[model samples]
Target: MSRFSPFSRSRAPQLLTEVLSRTDAFAPLRAGVEQMSAIRRDLDALLPDYLAASIEPGFIKDGKLALFAAHNALAARLRHLEPRLVADLQARGWALDGVRIRVRPQAVKDPVPPKQARMTPVGAAALQALSEHLEPSPLQAALAKMAARHTKR
Candidate 1:
């Protein structure tokens, strides 16, 4: 197939690989991404399953590895394991100096809960009764209005 074959005929993975590798501008970025991915795999292999899932590997700069945790609790756990982790990484051939753990919570889209009725039916009835007993005034009017809102037809 021609190098410029239509996307319909060429697989996305092959096209992406070709573009990332062939472009001089993308070569360094691709290499950096690959290195980070490799580091992440190694880190995950060394960590416990629960910890591994919450930790993300960042770039290694100036002989130090940057790690991102899902929350402060995980970051604290990582800090406690920093010395051991650094040693392990060094043993695995990384010229590591220290570990930097930063909390970077993942974005979660949680649906808002439906609002609950603030005034219960019984409370509404009580307000209505109190308003009826009170003389005609702003307070009585306000109470009656609020009760009307909460009471069922």
Candidate 2:
């Protein structure tokens, strides 16, 4: 039997556990993490007030944004605008490789998307007048025919 020493310090060796040193210890360190996911960004932003009265951001996966809308009408509206939304995201350097949208029914009133002007101007009559006066070169005839094809009945 060993005699007890009153003044002895800790005899345990220092542990070298792999779990403490691994990246799994901290969740925020994962790479390619989208802190602002697609649902959080677009559906939360661009959904119109008329339609936004019942929806919110949902899950985002593989560039797809899932949104919760009040009903089928709002879901239809958001689905209609998906492509344009993707374009806007690309312009802003958002990480949507190919953004997809999914609709889920929600249970709350939401604020509307702010009113914005249509950015592109409608073509004026002046362009048509210019085209009408141009001499009938092949290009001119072709344009005139093309315009005729597109002209309202």
Candidate 3:
């Protein structure tokens, strides 16, 4: 029998938390994840839906809780509510002395218009006139061809 069976290529048999908790190397990471999860839950419960949804829990360390805001405006708004948020988390046993907000805006992609093959009527007329004035040569022929190509359909 093949050691790598096709049937065994299914989804993971255990939960991610279960797998991560089992590894000694991931202990600190797991703890950090847990802390962040708690911070998010508490923030969601304490703040308005719009504010809570816009802010992401960055980390909590050395008696400080850090949060990520989508923009400076959001960060400023969060700052206004920071004291209340800190009190709420501290009341809930978070051991937080202060709250810090960081602006971490996500990259936005603007749609670009495709380049168009275009020429003004006046430009084409000028090129055509110049071509006619030139002697019969490769340059004149090339200019005539270019002017014709640029003419409106």
Candidate 4:
């Protein structure tokens, strides 16, 4: 019979860090990712809430910062703000000459419409009967109104 041993679990972040640190080939890639993330944070801070939420930071190469907008409208808006954004980023210690905006629409699934509660004819009749038995109170009035509304559908 062969003996087997269970594998120990390791955290994904720790494992990824170890791999990136030990591999020289991944150093540049890791650096690029960290730089982009930092730039993204800074950009988000400088942008308006609506624009920041719709934009994503891309690569920075040759003194130009690339940005991805959710759609053409957003891209146009970003282009309008590009000069001011570049100056702000420069003030924040980023050596930016210009910004390039690109439209990259994200895949968003259409939300399923909520199922509306529908009252049956019998249920409406029951509510009407119950309302009639009760005195002229707010609850009775509401029930009658609901029954009348549902019965018309």
Q: Which one is best on TM-score? A: 4
Ranking by TM-score: 4, 3, 1, 2
RMSD (CA, angstroms), candidate 1: 12.2
Q: Which regions in candidate 1 have their CA more than 4 angstroms from the true location? A: 1-18, 109-153
lDDT of model 1 at position 55: 87
| Sliding window of 10 residues with minimal summed lDDT for model 1 | 8-17
Candidate 1 similarity to native, TM-score: 0.61
Question: What digit string (tens of lDDT, one per residue) describes model 2 on residues 109-144?
Answer: 588989663222224244455668998787777665
Against the unseen true structure, what C-alpha lDDT does each candidate score?
A: 0.89, 0.58, 0.87, 0.89
TM-score of candidate 4 to 2 decimals: 0.66
lDDT of 3 by residue, 44-113 (tens): 8999998888889987778778899988998999999989888888889989899878998967868887
Ranking by lDDT: 4, 1, 3, 2
List candidate 4 segments past 4 Å from native.
1-18, 115-153
Residue-wise lDDT of candidate 4 within 19-40, one digit each (tens)? 7778789999788878887998
Count of steric clashes across candidates, in order: 0, 4, 0, 0
User: Local error of candidate 1 at 72, Å?
Assistant: 0.6
Worst ten-residue run, lDDT, model 3?
7-16
Model 2 poorest ten-residue lDDT run: 117-126
lDDT of 2 at 112: 92
- What does candidate 1's lDDT look like per residue over 25-57, in tens digits? 998888888888788888888999999998899
